[model samples]
Target chain A: DAGITQSPRYKITETGRQVTLMCHQTWSHSYMFWYRQDLGHGLRLIYYSAAADITDKGEVPDGYVVSRSKTENFPLTLESATRSQTSVYFCASGLDRGRSYEQYFGPGTRLTVT
Target chain B: EDKVVQSPLSLVVHEGDTVTLNCSYEVTNFRSLLWYKQEKKAPTFLFMLTSSGIEKKSGRLSSILDKKELFSILNITATQTGDSAIYLCAIGANNLFFGTGTRLTVIP
Candidate 1:
């Protein structure tokens, strides 16, 4: 009841459609991150926020956008979905950075673009 | 760019057996190495090794990092069916970089 949670655990959408996945944490971590997992690839960071209203692009942030309006929420949006965008999305939060304190991850949202 | 690589991409073992998973990395400003056990959902932290030669243990899981070799290994002894999950190795600098992960399945 007091961990990270993601909305719409599974989503199916068509190309060019806009969709947003929500992530919320109760711990109020200083850093929040979004990652995508694809077959044959592990997890790649999409976007990361250092604090409220501060966000930065990660390895694969081309088609994705993220914003942290508050320390507890970091939402990711797909401007226009594509088939290539289909993957599992994970939201993570860290007290600081790195794995020193172990970042907490959400259950993950499985998105499929048809 | 920092990178992490895991070996034996996947492994199958019987319960009560011992398994070793490997992770190697090339990171700038290295700080520590971490291991996580993922099963169906989010990955849970297993161990975080900050120094070489010293082993960290939690239950049946143990891990060691060798900074000079730029590698780490996770050992699960007396594995149980619940031990079936993806073991992810991450190298942390200022940020954390995760490897592809080793998927381990322990059968009865």
Candidate 2:
């Protein structure tokens, strides 16, 4: 069950160069998200994690950077990449988020920094 | 300030025609109200509304929620052409906020 998997599904870096978008999941979910789907700005949240090392900072977290240590990884880093950071990047997994749940996405990476 | 607003950002029906997608939120303490369906990769889960009016179907898609008019509506009755795509509205207090979607285009 690939359940959730994303990793360089597509990429074309440039600008400041430094991209890393990798998210893996196998059910062991406990909240983990990082979104970025531009064009009218639909999915923003840039980072989140509620387990493993714990992390937070969404709603377009600046340049972006995240790490969940493990519990089914959660990685998203753009360090310097720019060109508005291209777009189309989503990786989600949830089992709980306070009271909401229905998140389980991964089949997107399509970054194009130039 | 947490917010999630989705409206007629775009729409074009045809096929069986029957679409209504709208989501409004002001997040603070409220919880749960989600519906996603974005074709072309990622964005699936379709319904999840916390109480309010109690209506969540699956077959032809359905959803409902109106915590005192906070807003939430997604109903696709006979629409086809794979039901087009781009119809997302998310809101889960404490976190999760997404809107700016609603680009359904079901034509055949």
Candidate 3:
């Protein structure tokens, strides 16, 4: 109950539709991140937040948007979902700026776009 | 760009066997290395190693990092079917950079 959690563990939407995945962390960590996992690509960061209302893009930021209005919540939105956007999404919170800090991940949300 | 690479893309082993997962990295200002076990969902933290905390162990899982070599290894002893998962190795720079991950499957 004190850890990170994701909503709608599984989701499906049609191409061009808008979809949003939610993440919540109770630790109130200063740093939050969003990543996508595909078959061979491993986990690629899509966006990261340093603090409330401050967010930055990661390696794969295209086709996605993230906002952090509060320390406990970081939501990822797919403005126009595409078939390639179907993948597992993970949310993480780190106590520090990532260096020498371990991250705690949420359960993950699997999205299928067709 | 920062990068992490893992070896033995996939492995199949029988229960009770021992396995080693390898991870190497190239990053600016390396700070730490981490290992995680991923089953059906997100990855759970198994070990975190830094210059100050170079070795960490829990149960049958153990890991160590070598700053000189810029690499790390994770060893699983007397593995069970429950150990079947994707073993991920990540290197922490200013941000965390993950390796390709090793897919381990243990059969009983």
lDDT tens digits by residue: candidate 1, B1-108: 688999889999999999999999999998989998899988888888999999998888899999999999999999999999999998777667789899999999
Clash pairs, model 1 backbone: none
User: Which 10 consecutive residues of model 3 chain A have the lowest summed lDDT?
Assistant: A94-103
Taking the tens digit of each residue's C-alpha lDDT, what string does model 3 give over B1-108?
788889999999999999999998889988778898899888888888887435788998888888888888899999999999999998777677888799999999
Candidate 2 Cα outliers beyond 4 Å, as residue runs: A1-12, A15-34, A38-44, A47-77, A80-110, B1-14, B17-30, B35-50, B54-62, B65-73, B77-83, B89-93, B97-105
True-contact fraction in model 2 equals 0.81
Instruction: Give all candidates' CA lDDT scores.
Output: 0.90, 0.87, 0.90
Consecutive 10-residue window with the lowest summed lDDT within model 2 chain A: A95-104
- Count clashing pairs, candidate 2: 0
Q: Model 3: per-residue lDDT, tens digit, A1-114?
A: 799999989999999999999999999798999999998889999999999999999889999999998999999999999999999999999886644258889999999999
Arrange candidates by TM-score, highest first: which order? 1, 3, 2
Ranking by DockQ: 3, 1, 2
Q: Give the TM-score, chain B only, in order for the candidates.
A: 0.97, 0.34, 0.95
Model 2 chain B TM at 0.34
Per-residue lDDT for A85 in model 3?
Answer: 95
> Least lDDT summed over 10 consecutive residues: which range in candidate 3 chain B?
B47-56
